[model samples]
Target: NSILGFQGNRDLALNMINWLSSDEDLISIRPKDPADNRITLSRAQMQGLFYTSVILMPLAIVLAGVSVWWRRR
Candidate 1:
């Protein structure tokens, strides 16, 4: 369980870093002015997040519940 949780967290962190690194607007060499607040998410990226969260969250919950139930039994 601990190993699975660690791997899940690592996967999420890697995905976040990859997404941030790939965003051209977010990786400006010159720091943007504080007033600039433009954020964009492409359709595909939004869909990916939606799907990943929807799928992974439930799977994680189910796994956790089963783990607890197994331990109690």
Candidate 2:
């Protein structure tokens, strides 16, 4: 902001620094934009999570139930 000569930077930086220093004047809800919040998952990671939940999990449950049933018999 200093190099760009934008006024917004001065307010933002000062607020952040003051907040870090525990200044009472700057006290309020911190600024946040929902659009900036994000979760990034690669395609492979997404596929692996889906497969674990959809396929491997149910198969594990069926195997466990079968083991218990066989033990009872």
Clashes of each: 0, 0
Question: Model 2, range 3-52, lDDT digits (tens) per residue?
Answer: 53363565567778888998959744455446676779999999999999
What residue runs in model 1 are displaced by over 4 Å at the alpha carbon? 1-38
Give the TM-scores of the predictions, in the order they appear. 0.41, 0.49
TM-score computed on alpha carbons, candidate 1: 0.41
Reference-based lDDT, residue 1, model 2: 43
List RMSD in Å for every model shown. 20.2, 7.4
Residue-wise C-alpha lDDT for candidate 1, range 1-73, written one tens digit per residue: 3663443565555566667788544432333347767869999998988888999888999999999999999
- Residue 66 error, candidate 2, Å: 0.5
lDDT of 1: 0.70
